[model samples]
Target: MGGSDSRCLRCGSTKSREVRIFDDPQSLSEAVAASNMPKEIADELEKRISSYNLRLQKPHSAESHSSQHVAAMMDATGDDGQLTLSSLSRSLERMDIHGTTAEKLIGQAEFEGRLIREGQDTWSWLQQSS
Candidate 1:
């Protein structure tokens, strides 16, 4: 409702400002599609919605979300991405993922070359995977 510099609350950006859709998902998706929003914002909304749907449909599918979270963490960790088991455990806990899931996800990431073991309870991101 401000001037040309009005910020979008969802994305905190000034470009492609629009209203939030609170109706059914089908209608909301259609509104998003027809809006003048940026592609990145649209894609992010889609991803978040998809992730939420997946979590609702399959509670045990948290592993998939964990992988995505791990990748995001790696991105934020920079080139020499290094992490400890305790740190990873705490991160997963913050995401509401507990128990052996964190350890399992780290093992899977290492197996997929997304991460590499550096030492006991320590790991590093594999830049080649990015």
Candidate 2:
């Protein structure tokens, strides 16, 4: 058979590299274990793969994520200590949270008395009573 195409359409380069695809970390670990690679190198790869798997398994609930965003927005508030809807929207967008989820988070904050509407597009953070 003829040589495979090595040209990259976007970069217009002919350079190519071997790519290994694994369904999951377990399979990759299995492959590494079965390989004849050096012990130290294989150990390092396993460590990295284990770390990646741990991160993937970490639980991140919507409530916790929203709370974190709210805390960040509070910290970012100006001297007036007000958070604008636009600002909150931008922050949420940066966090990859948008659309109805963003709307719901805003509504939830207001419902929980964490925010008080000060104007049409602005809100003031309500400090929790001790």
Candidate 3:
């Protein structure tokens, strides 16, 4: 531990910082509660919470967890996010990553100006290899 700027509660190790838990409303509320902050600060921070309700939200059932989906991400990313339509979907039995994370990865790839969506479950990197 170089300094006392931060501490890990489990290991009592210094040099760790608090991490925001923003996965869902429940987790977020717990984080906000454990923060031990004042009402004003909590209220203000609540406005900045990032919710992933839409991305993985199923209309009639709870969201699913698919190992196949992680496999798909690994393939599409190829240890990177440059992907092809066939490669991406060949492994995706279901899209179960946190909706926002999936969207962010896709959006980031797209923002780098390369993501191409061919159909509902098809996509590829458009800028070739840079």
Candidate 4:
């Protein structure tokens, strides 16, 4: 597998990095026991039972994430602001939220109306539940 760098894959500007990796078997088991992670995750862990080197990827996903940046930006918008999904997706990418968690995050964020997608390279605001 290839590694992602610290720079934006699309733009050359420096990214505000936020994600981290944790893959220890014991820790993984503990986290699994604690959270409401979906069924596929539990099933995926079966592979780790046989393999010792299965590196765990991003822990928290976008759906589970609420941006301090967006929160602050939207503070003035109150209950009616808008945060686009693409920008939130980009923020999630910056936060290193990936894989299944990322999908869940997108789903949850949309469910909460925190983001709205308009067009390519376009987004207006991010609404945090008031």
List all candidate RMSDs to the true structure. Answer: 17.9, 15.2, 18.6, 23.4
lDDT of 2 by residue, 51-73 (tens): 98877765655556656767657
Candidate 1 wrong stretches, greater than 4 Å? 1-68, 71-80, 98-100
Against the reference, the lDDT scores of all candidates come to 0.70, 0.73, 0.56, 0.51
Give all TM-scores, in the order shown.
0.41, 0.44, 0.26, 0.25
Q: How does model 4 fare in lDDT?
A: 0.51
Flag clash pairs in model 2.
none
Task: Please report the candidate that would top TM-score against the real structure.
Answer: 2
Model 4 spans > 4 angstroms off: 1-80, 101-103, 110-130
Question: TM-score of model 2 relative to the true fold?
Answer: 0.44
Model 2 regions lying over 4 Å from their true place: 1-60, 98-102
Candidate 3's displacement at residue 119, Å, is 0.8
Using lDDT as the yardstick, the better of models 1 and 2 is: 2
lDDT of 4 by residue, 19-129 (tens): 545678888677758466677877788667546443332224332334544343343232434444454556555655444343454455456675554555333445345
Off by over 4 Å in 3: 1-74, 77-100
**Candidate 2 — worst ten consecutive residues by lDDT sum?**
97-106
lDDT of 3 by residue, 1-130 (tens): 6744666778878766657658789988887675778988877665655344443465423323334443555666655445554455444534433433455455555676657765564456565665
